[model samples]
Target chain A: MDNNKLQAKDFITIGIFTALLFVVEFACGILGFIHPYIVASYVIMIPIVGSVPMMLFYTKIEKFGMLSIMSVLLAIIMFVTGMGYLGAPLIIGAGVIADLIAKSGGYKSFKKTVLSHGVFCLWICANYFPVIVTADSYRKNLVDGGYSTEYCDNLFRAINSKTIAVLLILCFVFGVIGAFIGKAVVKKHFEKAGIV
Target chain B: MALKLDPRTKLFMIFIVSAVVMMSATTPLLWAVRITMTMIPIFLLIAEKHYAAALRFIVLYSAALLISFKFLSENSKGFLSAFLVGYCSIIVQFMPAVITAWYVVRTTKIGEFVSAMQKMHVPDGITISLAVVMRFFPTIKEEYSSIRDAMKMRGIMFGGGNVTDVVEYRMIPLLFSCVNIGDELSAAAVTRGLGGKVKRTSVQELKMGGADYMLILMFTAALVFFVVFKYMK
Candidate 1:
């Protein structure tokens, strides 16, 4: 078997980690309904929470395209769950770039993995794309879609076009931070257990 | 007869419903179209003998619609009302896509899904990975519940009040089991010739029957009606 080509095992690993990551995202998503600020804080919540599985995934990454495939799956899931396709480009873009970053490190260097995971985490901000891109129409749609005026106000206040830049930065920074935490936890638990 | 729709048709239904879901229904006519689109999946669920789920979804969706229409409005105030409105509105807005997706996931077998995707010429990586993902949600839920049960037995409630610990206690164990399961799964799949260089054949043969075409036509009509009405003023 050629070591360069991803096999059935690699795809299964990607699938498992993607499912785990989506579970984390769904859990954090339910919390966002309580407050729009919590919605804004998905940057902090998902990356930190989701990084555990992802770090484990990174350890299994011997070849390329795994991260990218995971991102495509994430985009498909986001659409199916009614999150819209406005974010597909950003999600896949981040995934491929993250893949390349990790590849440059031979998928082993800690610094590149951290940066790759950070780049990968930028996909979380894709949730806010519709809000930022079509500000007026989206607000109107929210109101028309039965969200109360106050909810729309708060949601918009917390996540408008201007705030998206900041949100993106926070997503990346916390992604870097979460990668370290994820790596440490993986080390503490999986490496000791020989799973890693 | 049991209404066994093609997986391709199911995928089309998901595509249409999600597109409609992205755009809000402004007028009563559009809302009617949207509601009809939503009901088709529930009806399919019922047809598939998922009566309990169908009933639950219907009751919850109707209740949310009634509350949103009668009590909550654009100007509903206060935190409790806001919370209520938020939940109800979310239900009203995303219920169709959720119901369709749920129906698809619950009713379709993994073999059929993979064969359908194969027929459509999707990449093997995405297809296999997505099939695993679709097949794994229930396993994850089962694993999570068992973990919760074990945690409860140990009196580790709420991770002793530390939020990170709460996350760590649950997540680490879940990951451990999932990785182990993935290993087992890949072994099983490879034994079944999953990654062979030759194209794999399936026991499940996919064909678009009458029901598939009919449902596809209905969904396409609904999507076109929605976009034209909502956008082309």
Candidate 2:
């Protein structure tokens, strides 16, 4: 029972990695302003860029709940940053599913880890929820809120309901690819340093 | 005077501001309410003696507001105008929540935050992880700067012109340091009796005061005013 329980150490690890992941997200998010297509590409950008810290995190995870807690944190942060609560369910859902997948692999199997990561990366799609679910109103809000019509048109073009399915698949595929790259990086650095 | 507020009140302020921020203000009156809501946090920052930050936020926000209102419109075309509009609108749209979040994070100590969370019956896992997250941002910034300095000394500018190198050079070092720091942080936490079986006690007792009540009332009023004016109208 004690072995299964999360400790202070686990919490700190989750906190550190969550912070790192957020930094990566914020950095990539800044570029979306340059072009709407960049916004749609967050799936590719975040998973690959964020995977290094995540893979390192995976190496440290010998228990469950870490990823789930991290997702809950991400949801709260997204809300606090004014991303709205629309995506909160998807974010938390992806986290729990990712946690279960990793657990099923006993947190050691490489195939399970990659698949778990792919599932976890779906949270990136949650950012598109407002755009898809409230398309008309959200577009109206943007135009009313000072965004250019061109920008809105492009945004909706790149990320409407139909394109979202493709984006989710891209996010998962890139997540799997990112996992392998992240594992290599971890092996190249952390494993050599005896930190893993 | 250093007007200390209860963490709960500050959190409520965050909640209200974020909620208001999510919904765009359409009418002038709604905008007025929104601007005023944003100002309260700036004033609170000033009251907290964060003079530099308050002044900086005021300048940036008002400048963005001026540029967006005076210069840009929906019909404004071209890349430069679009770029300016994008930047200005982003600042105008999200700055309020950002400022409020910054104020809350800057003012609230970790112990106070944790105790308040416990008082609210938050799970220990979430609370502890959240507290660490709150404490780790500044540390990351500090570590990042040091890494940048080291890179400069080696003359490894912008990952030697490779995009992957740009990411790899910075990210790998950052990850290593963060992992090490996490270990050290957990050790310190364990030494302090964190995750112990006994129910923990706090050194700083939390109590809501007049300021807390006043701020809560004001924020609630602002939220109510925003919603009613935006939707009911």
Give the top-scoring candidate (lDDT).
1
Model 1, A2-64: lDDT tens per residue?
888989999999999999999999999999878888999999999999989999999999899
In candidate 2, what are the lDDT values of residues B45-105, reduced to their tens digit? 9999999999999999999988887655446577777778777877898999999999999
User: C-alpha displacement of B71 in model 1, angstroms?
Assistant: 3.2
lDDT of 2 at B121: 95
Residue A43 miss distance in model 1 (angstroms) = 0.4
Q: Tell me the lDDT of model 1 at A160.
A: 92
lDDT per residue for candidate 2 within A9-91, as digits (tens), equals: 99999999999999999999998878879999999999999999999999999998999999999999898887878999999
Give per-candidate clash totals.
Answer: 0, 0
RMSD of 1: 1.4
User: Candidate 2 at residue B120, lDDT?
Assistant: 96
For each candidate, what TM-score against the reference?
Answer: 0.97, 0.97
